[model samples]
Target chain A: MKSMLRTETQSKRRWRYVYAIIPSRKEHDFGQIGLDDENVYTIHYREIAAVVSDSSTKTFEVLDYGITHQQALEKIMKEYCVIPMSFGQSTTEGDIKTFLSRNYPKLRIYFTKLVGKTELGLKVTWKIDTTIKEIASSNIKIRAMKHQIEGKPLEKTYRQRLTLGTKVAEELTKREEKIASEIFARLGRISADAKMNKNLSDEMVLNAAFLVDKTKEQDFDTLVNTLEQEYGEKLLMKYVVAPPYNFVNVRIRS
Target chain B: MALIVDDLLRLPVDLGMKVLQAIADDADAMTLKTERAVREQVLKTQMQFERGDLPEEEYRATMSQLRKRLDEVKGV
Candidate 1:
């Protein structure tokens, strides 16, 4: 009796949840859409793949067939690099179609120009110690303070030393910002264009994306290699090119 | 075929549905045993600091412990 009432209310105010489809396939399909035991089709918009979520639960499920979404997103991502919607997005198929239909003129122009390109992301992480060591060598003031604070009681000196730790972290961040600027300038010299995702974290410097012509990937890597060689002592950088979707992670290996 | 609960008895905490159930069902994932626990374990420290119930040093030490435990339970 309760379920029947719930279903009645559901039918009256029906809505679909949204799913962000990260596809492994390089080719985008525009068929009648794939369906499960229930009938629903995914709306593949440019590189931003969207699908309505299941209705019974408020949750929009994500499936990872261990075909890692990263690689899958990249495979399809090469087709037409586009904006990825931020999390918790939902819309009906008909609304999406109307959206696409209305914006077809603008999209066609954007798609045609972006047909033969992919976005490559590069992030440089400095081993914290290396940068700290580098900074410690450069800053005599900090070294003097470090030496002065020794031979004191733990309570008196512990917080004092932590302030130094915070100082070192701040200096390390400034150095990364400097290197990041240099890298972006260098990328502009090599690529058709570049975009930098600048964030101050111990993890990565040079968080940047480049619009590399398909033929220019090797040249881009070769350039990156040269930069890495010159600066590899203090910084370690890795790259992830934007896959077909608006490229955007966490802990468990599982 | 499966064991079903027909009678009410004080049992274990509710593992909230789906992927979370596995961890939540475990005794370890009690995180906060109840809403009261949220207030007692986490918010109380924060409130005490605001209310001048704890010195800054004591508040920080206690808060760090709660943060560490919360991190472990939340897997953040």
Candidate 2:
């Protein structure tokens, strides 16, 4: 009867959706501020605690619930060094305890690495037409080809057109690389680490995440401002401050 | 009643048809590749569910979105 009752109780247990893991010796209850506004709390094991909330289901809506997850991590980050989990990280309380126990060493390493650290994003895009025009003017062969292909039927000069297109693409890649590397090197100097992300669109030239020290936030901001002025209209820069950089910081499956 | 050899043969029409067939084949290949990608995503999402790393509703929505993208690529 005792064993049967234990099995029954385990089967009836609810799952918790995890938002982030923090190194804490004590348990905390942040209250009903998580996704679905359920009672958010922690499940502590050893020296780490998973900041979580009661979840009705085993999955999460990525975009809609993503905002809630981000908010919870940001809230926790204010008071603790959080290793932010992905948006859909849901698990039972028992599993969370097991996960923490198994990954305690890795978790501790991340906590040490991320102490007083946060992620910042920088995106730079250039006006498409202007960039194309600039490239065409600079490359003599491309300029000549452009003039030669003008008003010609594609069927007749298709090969020449293809070649010109390839050449232009190569030139553009070279230019983008030069610019991207300059920015990467400059930003990498002031940050603990950096990750270059794929551009979302053709116009975007740089999409990077920097794991920066909390103390160097101002320095990073000033550098971005200076670079923006230096690049002027050639590059449109956007800097996102105070967001989790899971791409660089989170070690999946660890 | 007098038709030129080029006009009578109508080579462009045959070439045009061949081009259309090639385009159809290319589109089919693209659709197949996208379908495979969707399948892989579904499997990954299922693993997330088993580990309680993802919610069921979110999985459904994501699968639906992937299906929609596949339909678009297939031009359906």
DockQ of each candidate's interface versus the true one?
A: 0.02, 0.05
How well does candidate 1 score on lDDT at residue A22?
Answer: 32
Score residue A156 of candidate 2 by CA lDDT: 89
Q: What docking class should model 2 receive? A: incorrect
Candidate 2 residue B13 Cα shift, in angstroms, is 28
- Model 2 TM-score on a 0 to 1 scale: 0.70
Cα lDDT tens digits, model 2, A144-221, are 876776666758866666676667667867888898889989998999988887775556789887889999999998
Clashing pairs in 2: A58-B54, A58-B55, A59-B54, A59-B55, A59-B56, A60-B55, A90-B52
Error of 2 at A49 (Å): 1.4
Recovered share of real interface contacts in candidate 1 = 0.00
Alpha-carbon RMSD to native, per candidate: 17.2, 9.5
Write the residue-wise lDDT of candidate 2 on B1-76 in tens digits. Answer: 2133222122333344467689976875575466566556555654443223344577667657766766765679
